[model samples]
Target: MDEEYDVIVLGTGLKECILSGLLSVDGLKVLHMDRNDYYGGESTSLNLVQLWKKFRGSDKPPPQLGSSRDYNVDMIPKFMMANGTLVRVLIHTDVTKYLSFKAVDGSYVFNKGKIHKVPATDMEALKSPLMGIFEKRRARKFFIFVQDYDESDPRTHDGMDLTRVTTRQLIVKYGLDDNTVDFIGHALALHRDDHYLDEPALDTVKRMKLYAESLARFQGGSPYIYPLYGLGELPQAFARLSAVYGGTYMLNKPECKVEFDEEGKVCGVTSEGETARCKKVVCDPSYLPNKVRKVGKVARAICIMSHPIPNTNDSHSVQVILPQKQLGRRSDMYLFCCSYAHCVAPKGKFIAFVSTEAETDQPETELKPGIDLLGPIDEIFFDVYDRYEPVNEPSLDNCFISTSYDPTTHFESTVIDVLNMYNMITGKVVDLSVDLSAASAAEE
Candidate 1:
């Protein structure tokens, strides 16, 4: 193996993959290393069936159940462990199979009546149950303001820009009704409840609008693609593509100490009791600055897969459920289905994700109320899967549930940290991803 390279990337996350792949393509010798044995930092998929068998029991034929041939037999999605070190198997289906929507009264809507696919206009979308009335009004007004802004516009808003506003401000500014404000606030809380309560209303509005625009772009243009096989395929693709371009990927090598020369330039890195020399080093590991301290903050998510996908049809692709007073404060919960893609699950099985933000020290038991499966479960499932009859004594076989902790650092900030460090030394925007950041943060 070569003792030195032009660039050494120290993480295998998405950013690291992009940097390594691009540099290798540009004719620079690059080496990418990950402390873990597998790739795909956060977005990797797991083998769900295998995981279910390991955690619960092996798959067996159901008595009086439909023929085995009717069931979709395939490897389930994989997941990263709670601490982000190990990758394990999950249930074999995608989230759509278990998802259903209902009105506040717990009445189930039929599949045909689940989602009201209205026009893309703001007013029509607001009228749809995808958002609450107040939220719809706020979104309608906000969309009107940025309706003409394109990606090339100098004042285009991004996540940081949106962080400055609040949901209250957006509602008031738009003269939205109290009910509408509550709904919009609830939706925002659901999507970003972790940070929404304290975030500026103006920033929240901007960010939501940005996301809406991005969705619109994807709907009309080439959609952003996730890996077909699994999320793991993404990192593997980068590793394979990197190798094809003369880049090296060293797995299970954890960088212990970063060595810098007297001039403050990163000259080399020591990992797994061995040192590697490089002219430039990029750290792509999750929680860069934050990792230097403790394990970092993370959340717990459970993916439930049901057999013989229930016939529930909800118009919305995702559902946000705010906890009641009895559910305890700080217990934020959300549910979403895999609707954009079908390859994620087998033909007869669908998948759904139930997630809650948890503290690192708390036990999963403390978050049990958030995981209760009985409340509104039947109504929601019936709404989405009305055609199919649920097994008389429905058994949740081979389901997958696991927790993932997100690094305390934001994705955007991490990118900026890398680009700014490189720019200070190289005096240029070395990465296109870096170029995408606003100039305030991009410029050194």
Candidate 2:
């Protein structure tokens, strides 16, 4: 096997497959392989039998659960923001033609002890019950500042340069309370933690703008969207794109052993006694444990339900973020729900996931705040997996490794990881600027 490739991707995860597709479209020859027979490695959707087999092990699924083929439960649950980076990538690569998307119905945040719809726009801010009458006025002013904010428009700056101001300082400038700042920073801005308070306001403002723009795109109750079936559709769609661009894919290839050159750089990958020569390799952290370090742990609980999550306004699908401060924790907890409405489950069945960054050995205890919100569940399964990040620089070894998925319900953090890796590999940043007309066409 003397065939040489510009890049070799050793896993079928979403990140690797997306990279392969983008590189192939850029005219780089790519060889994509996965040890598993499926397209998604860590991020796959499983049917009832497969799902039960994975979690329950050897035990047969209950007959009352209906047809096994009717279920498509994602191992790692996450949704895409319609106008977010992932959607932009789909439109940029024309991958939307391979998939269908439905807007999520709700986005809620936990405050004190109740769930409230995140008020983003000024109108919502004015009517929001989360704040007192006086507080609503202050929040409305803050929302106005954010909505009118334009980096290039001095008229919209309001005498405070967001680039030079900390997010905490900007919040104080608007006279926002701690509770208002909590949801604004965690729910609307989608920050993982309150750590962004000390960071520049520019980042938080940009994130808030993205949420608003995405919400305006569909005029839906929420800013996020999910593909029909499940997230597993994403990797396969990208795989199709890579194939159309002349990239090769091999699945069920056993023992994918990576080879290193004398200079300690990736030279090729060996599988089934044949070596596929390539200049560089990209893969998930699992494929190269030695090159990765355990960063943290994610504890998640997957539940099957007969109805929508309580207090979500009966939304067919929803995302609920519980800010750390509300739960007296150091990180946010995510609640994601989808069901027959999204074609991922049987009729009248709903799937909900509660996940958070694990701080102790007890995951169920750590995620209790989120799980308590689900009134009743038919079946529930809990899982905890370690998170990993690469310790080596891609420029040094030519071996690029993707980090483990975080405990996020949205794709914003995931896409950021992908874009950073793309820049590292190509030595150029992928411009995220979108042409309004093009985005509209894709939506149509």
Candidate 3:
């Protein structure tokens, strides 16, 4: 406890753990501490008994749910894109060697009161029932334009400057209907709201390309994947990477209060009256509450089901996006489902989650639209957590804090937050241009 270090990470969440691993690999001495005994802070997965204790305030789970050891329910559930930024980071850091992944079975979007598979490529758009024959042709042209887009190749530009054009303007060129635009923006681009419509089209086009490429990776059903057990495997895998690089970890350490010097820059973290000295401090919003502001609240319902979500082709795992316009809400609603095949639940059982940015105080009522799509739920638990973002500057205080987890069912936003913090901490962008073949090697 007397030794000084380069950086002190104060949470065991996936973001903090990943940073710990990356910094340690960069030859920075890191000391990670968590007040909780668990490896994951807010993102921890719970067994059946622990799940019952959290939601029901009792340790006893129903016998019909099977043994407690068989359940690994994630508190902050999300799926990884098969070829997205996080996978690139996993390959860059070589952390994927510690984990296994399985491709998600479906990615559907709700439009015109029915769910349809998200058609990312031109061929899929032609075969999609979501659009009329003429509309499909227009959509195919739009998809082809996006697929051919290359920043470095003038031949692919087609006289359109994506950086200057709004996403709405780009879509208007194709004359796509409102329904087609809805899935293209929310399902493929994974935007939380229509705000992106007015933003430059460059980011939107890149997101669409990423989606198509991810879908092509496994050629299974969707563009997403999840670990065999649950998301709990993520933080633990990074923690192991950190350990292999000589980072120290301390759990069950209570009262992890950040200590500042007289000039108000981070100097150390004091836990149980022993101050572990470090030049910079990295933590979640909760560790330094005064440095963060409440942005919104997330309302979610976790369900244990005996069957797959209806209308998803009986996929063992799936992601369903309900666009905000369809729900008459300010944000989109997401549904994620995984069954025994993922080893997150017992045989014949499925775990599903419906989450959204809360517009009302009643989460159960707010999430009804997504819950209704589940068909039947053997057991369900409703939860609401406040979202937060940092208000302080790390340059002045040397204290880097991560944002609270959002309600989205994918890790795109989460990884963005992590990468942004990594740049701030290390003063360098994380280069993720590794070979795609390296990503597949992670599963082996």
Candidate 4:
């Protein structure tokens, strides 16, 4: 099949899907391919049920038992696939487990147990035990101030500003109470790294402001726009959109060589025994260009699924548990997603993604238990584990543990860059499912 096209996209990531769609919509012939056998690359969904049955057992309650009916996973796959979406399931656990928390004074409280059912505002979040009193007030004030700005204003300025300041700096500058600072710090650490608190203050503020604005714009928006079935649903949407626009997708076929012209422009790519030619080529992988230039780095992530959602009131959304300390050297970061969407887990289960940034040469056994950036696990997990047995004793049978890595750039940063590249190549702004419209509107 010696066919030529107007453009050739090398990867099947969200950005690749978007570019392929945009180009094809313009009546351009496009060929899209990936070295992997499945679409959505890192975001591809595995069969959680099959994975659970293979690793744990076939007769366990589903992972998303307590979640709302609208967000349940039971029929999400069929619904999404019929609507031209693809989903990959990553089975981490058979049930949702909550980390029980004890106050400094020694009162045991289930973090993910009873529903708080408070107002969805930042103020309401502040009032909850999820954070300290002082921290809640400061966060409320900060969010209120941010909601006042328009993100889409042309004069809104670019790059880091006061709105983007790190949480640590925000706390310090505002003279917030230590407990409040600690809570906010822990929250940020849970999402990224403890060192993330050391990030540019403006960047932190901007991100917080964005979240605040998003909350304000959509009522109960936090639970409204979950990743439909599994996190993989996000990429699946892009994949389906790409296919509808006449782009070809292939997976498991690794690119053996990138054919470049003498002028250094990408001409086409080849994988296995097949060679495809095109005018433009795009590459977005996990390894940083600098690292790939030298020894190359690969990111490792571990998904942990346990019984009963741990430590929180809401079963619909993932609860981020942050570490207390700031100084540490670990590579893995922990993120818990309640399989409120049943596709990934059976009823009554939750999955947690414990990811670490490590070198490709590092052994799986040697990799730390969790991301080091969050600091010591004992400090964060000891109390919670003691109070609530998040993990089942001796572990459940179907708990599946899988590892994945990329040789391009960090997942979060690379994803955004891919979107930007899509905009650059296709001359159109990429629409991220998570509404950045508030940020855009503020800039305007």
Candidate 5:
């Protein structure tokens, strides 16, 4: 217990576990400890009884809801983009060998009081009803431009530099309507709001291109993928990778106390009166509350349903993005659903989640737009949690803290958070440029 380590991770959340794995793979001595007995801290999947107990304050699940073992409900619902950063990480660390994945069935965006499939390719763009005929042609041209864009190829630049141009300018160049821009920015690019429109166009273009590439990866209905059981498998897979690289793990370590020297730099962490010495500490914000502050709040509804989300083309698994413009809200609402086909539920059962950044005191009213889209729900649970970000300087404290997960129902923003934390902890960007295309589980 007195042995020293290069880094000590203090949570079993997806972000912490990934950091532990990456650091261990970098040949650093690592020890990961969690206050809970479970592998995933806040991101663990719950069965029917556990879900009911957590939300309803009882262990009694409805008899009509089927067996408890048939439900693998993710506490923090998200889907992986087939060609996104998380997939690159999985392949870079060879973690896919420890888990299996299947393509999500559909992706749609809400616009102007109707739902429409998000057009990632030119053919889909031409056929999409979200835009008028002229707007569709403009959108297709934009998509073609993005698909052919090459940073190193001057000819593909089209007399415009995305690095300096605002996304608004790029969209105006193609004469796309405001509605078309809304879905492109908020849905396909997965931006939280319209703020990205005023930012540099390069990142937004890259995000849209990634979405198209991911959709093409599986040639499926959507660009996303989910694991066999649920998202809980992800942290465990990373834990195994960390273990294979000699990182030690402990769960149910009560009252994990981060010890600091007189100068306030971290020296070790103590649990059960046994202190494990370390040069630095990596942890989620929950481990060091004093160093973090609430940046925002997330309101979500976990819904158990007998059918898939209505108007989603009967997809067993799907995501629907309700853009803020369509709902007259400040932030978009996300709906995610997976059914028996995804193995996250029993036969004739579906699990869906409606989530968004809380913009008002009444979460139920705020989420009503998304909830109404589910048609009807069997049982529903509502949760609102504060999102925290570290305010302390990691260099001064030798403590790297991960931010709380956001309300978005995709891994793009989550992976960026992880990558930023990795850079801050290791002083180098985590290189994840592995060939993820070859690792896609898509079998045509």
Candidate 6:
């Protein structure tokens, strides 16, 4: 308990575990501890009994729900992009050895009042029903522009500097209507809001290219993928990687109090009167509450269904994004659905989550639009949790605190935070170019 290390990670959340694993692989001694006796902290997947205990305050689950072990419900559900940063990180660490993945069945976007499949390429854009023939032709041209856009090749730029051009300007040049812009910005680029429309087009173009590339990778309906079980496998897989590289882990550790020196920098973490010394501390917002400030709240509905979401063509697993414009909301609403095909639920059972940043006090009412898309729900649970981010400077205190999980149903924002923290802790940008195409599960 008194041993010193380079860093002491105080939570087993996905963010913390990834940092622990990356730092360990970089040869930095890391000691990871969690107050809970589980691998995924706030992100843990709960079985039937645990899920019941969490929401109903009772350990007894209905027999009709099937075996308790048959359910692995993600507390903060998110999908991984086939060619996104998180996949690159997993490939870089070779942690895919501990995990297997399946391509998400579909990705759809809400337009007007109904869900439509998001077109990933120029051909799909031309064939999409979301736009009229002329609009589709215009959108196809825009998609071709994005697809052929090479930052290194000026010929593809068409004499427009995307870095200086606003996305709105680029869209207007192609005469894309508001509806087409809505899906391109929110569905394909996966932006939370329309703010990106006013920002430089470079980032938006990159996101679109990433989406197209990922879609091309698996030739799936969508660019996203999820593990066979659930996202809870992510932290455990990283923890195993950390262990393989000599990182230590301790679970069920009580009262992990961070101790500071007179100079106001983190020196160690104390548990049960024994202090384990370390030069730097990394943890989630819960571990160091005072250092984090409430940013927002996430309202989500967890639904157990007898069938897949209607209008998604009975996809075994899928992601549906209700862009803010369609619903007159301030942010996008995300719907994630998975079934027994992904091994997260019993046969004939499906798990779906509708989540968004809470704009009002009533979560049920806030998530109704998304819930209405699901035909029927056998069992449903509603939850609202406050989101937080570190208010303190890590360089000043040597404490790198991770922000709370956002309401988005993807790993882009989460991986951004992890990579940012890794840079802060190690003073080096994480190189994620490690080729993962050879890995069996890289795009399963």
TM-score for predicted model 4 compared with the true structure? 0.59
State each model's CA lDDT, in order: 0.40, 0.90, 0.92, 0.40, 0.91, 0.93
Compose the digit string of candidate 6's lDDT tens values, residues 321-430. Answer: 99998999999999999989888989999999999999999999999999999988999999999999999988899999999999999999999999999999999998
Q: CA lDDT of 115 in candidate 5? A: 78
Give one digit per residue, the lDDT tens place, for model 2 in 182-257.
Answer: 9999999999988899988999999999999888988889998898889899999999999999999899999889
Q: Name the candidate, 4 or 6, with the larger lDDT value.
A: 6
Q: To one decimal, what is the Cα RMSD in angstroms of model 4 from the true structure?
A: 13.0
Q: What would the per-residue lDDT of candidate 3 be over residues 1-444, giving only the tens digit for each residue?
A: 788999999989988998898899889999999999998899999999999999999998889999898899999999999998889889899987878888899999998788888999999999999999999999999999999899999889888888899999998888988988999999999999999999999999999999999999988799998888898999999999999999999999998999999989999999888998999999999899999999999999999999999899999899999999998889999999998899999999999999999998899888999999999789999999999999998999999999999998999999999899989999989899988777674331
Global lDDT for candidate 4?
Answer: 0.40
Off by over 4 Å in 4: 48-122, 130-140, 149-170, 182-202, 216-224, 250-256, 271-274, 284-306, 314-317, 323-332, 358-414, 423-444
Clashes found in each candidate (C-alpha, N, C closer than 3 A): 42, 0, 0, 83, 0, 0
Top lDDT prediction, candidate number: 6
Which has the higher lDDT value, candidate number 2 or candidate number 4?
Answer: 2
Worst 10 residues of 6 by lDDT: 435-444
Q: Per-residue lDDT of 3-80 in model 5, one digit per residue for the tens? A: 999999999999999899999999999999999999888889999998988988899997999999999999899999
Can you write out model 4's per-residue Cα lDDT over 67-111, one digit (the tens) per residue? 333232211111111001111110111001111111010111112
What TM-score against the true fold does each predicted structure earn? Answer: 0.57, 0.98, 0.99, 0.59, 0.98, 0.99
Candidate 3, after superposition: displacement of residue 433 in Å?
Answer: 1.0
Q: What is the C-alpha RMSD of each candidate to the true structure, in Å?
A: 13.7, 1.3, 1.0, 13.0, 1.1, 0.8
Which model, 2 or 3, shows the larger lDDT?
3
